[model samples]
Target: MRRTLTAALSIAMVVALSGCTLVSTLAAGDTPTDTPTPEITGSGDSTTDPSPPDDGGSDVDGSGDDGAGDGPPAIPSDVPLALGEAGEIEGRGGNPVGTFQVDGVTTGFDDCVEPEEGLSYVQVDLTITAEDDLAAEEGSLDYATSFALFLLYVKGPNGEYLGDWLGHECVPSSEWIDDVGPGESATGSVWMSVQTPVDEGLIEWRYGHQNFVVPFP
Candidate 1:
């Protein structure tokens, strides 16, 4: 009887020891460990985000539509100049006359054969000098075609362009100069009829693709 009891106690002690070992192993396996996170770095072939698309907004260049219907380009600058102040003569034969200037501008003409209502006449006094002795053509200086080539117009205070006018009546018409030798000049007046009460305006002249402007007084 004593021997059997001792054997049974030995078996129980061995089983308890085995069960404790298994529990310890399971606890160790279930526990979590501290791990380090990886660092991120950019690649050499990385690309940047593209720019936004054009939304058809403001005009970067002055050539784009400004909401004001189609028309000639706006005035480059607002600098006021005078008619014939810095004019360059252009004609056949290398421009026999070189310098041209507007001596004066006269308005409110009292002598008009057929004056129309709501219109007034403006006379521009011009002095054209010859750079060299020009040969006389048909016993007179023939500048009718040259005068016709010039474009004369008016600009309102708001930069609106008025069409060209050609109905001129001068005592000595600019087209009828008798003769002009070197160091000599010819003086005359050219007239134009326009809307009355022109308080502030600009006289625009175009000659051979060149443009010039002068403030009207």
Candidate 2:
């Protein structure tokens, strides 16, 4: 009986140890799993940014933002050319008499003479060419004589007559061209002083009943 009791006690102790080991294994298996870490590529501020606005800036052709065409208006091919333009005028016998161009315009007085009160001297650089055919018919270009016959009429921007020619007193005499033969050209300066300064106006070259209006600079 003593032996049997001892053996029973030993068996109970072994069972208790085995149960403890099984409990430990089950507890370890039931533990909550750890979550995986996300992959980080770049630095801070990972949120996606918004796109930029489209301002109507200059175009590839260098036009304005308004998309208007290129530079100044196209000059008409008529007899009276615009400022800094050249054209020919038909004279007697239905032939082109001469080609004229207003090269430039100058204002203010030099050391030689002063302009009248409320007036300023405006000098127009004129270039006139007479081809061989016209020069043969009307003789050579005599500026001192024929220039007055051109009947140059100056008008303000509002079509008001500026005044008569101020004469060649202002410009140097050496700059004057008295004549030009066939196949030749003459360049001279014409001066005028108006009571009101001419900002933009028309210089009409009138002869007989025909007139050609040229714009001022």
Candidate 3:
């Protein structure tokens, strides 16, 4: 009777040990996946991070720039080029076209043309010597289109392009000449309207959907 009891006890112990072994093996293999999860950081998620690249990007400070596909190529808000400091013009193929200079800038000159209340008239003197026919067109430049197509702007004190420079239609007070052929030079003033009581800002010029700037000192 004692020997029967000992065999039974041994069988029970063996069965218990086998159950524990099987449970441990299953627990070891119960991982959801073999791949380790990627950690997220710094304006990104679900990807492993690497060393950042070194490349400059666009510099937009969120100022009011109407990016309504104005030009085929995107125009940037670069630093202002100085007045009378522009070099010889370059052709489409980058050949020298001609020369131009901002001979003078006059502000607050309200002669016969009456500006609206709280506004003033500013004029820019342009002298252009064109080697080609196209550059000559810039001499007696006329923007008969909407106000947005105006060629020149006198930036207000707030650093915004809130000025108006119409074509040479205000007749008697303007010395703006026309029919400037190639190899000839023309000097004229392009009048613009700026906010009154403005003592600072830049002057912006547009040509062929591109923009240029000349700061006010």
CA RMSD per model (angstroms): 11.7, 16.5, 12.9
Better of 1 and 2 by lDDT: 2
Candidate 3: stretches off by over 4 Å: 1-72, 76-79, 113-115, 133-149, 157-159, 167-174, 177-181
User: lDDT tens string, model 1, 103-175?
Assistant: 6666665566566677776666666665543332122222333333145666666667643453554344434
TM-score of 3: 0.49
Per-residue alpha-carbon lDDT of model 3 for 36-57, expressed as tens digits?
A: 8788568655465585655545
Q: Write the per-residue lDDT of candidate 2 for residues 146-190, one digit (tens) a residue.
A: 334235556787768885467536556676444444567888877
| Residue 61 C-alpha lDDT in model 2 | 73
lDDT of 3: 0.58
Task: List clashing residue pairs in candidate 3.
Answer: none
Which parts of model 2 have CA positions greater than 4 angstroms off?
1-78, 109-114, 135-150, 177-181
The clash numbers for all candidates, in the given order, read: 2, 0, 0
Q: In terms of TM-score, how similar is model 2 to the real structure?
A: 0.52
**Against the hidden reference, what TM-scores do the models get?**
0.43, 0.52, 0.49
Ranking 1 against 3 by TM-score, winner: 3
Using lDDT as the measure, what is the rank order of every candidate, best first? 2, 3, 1
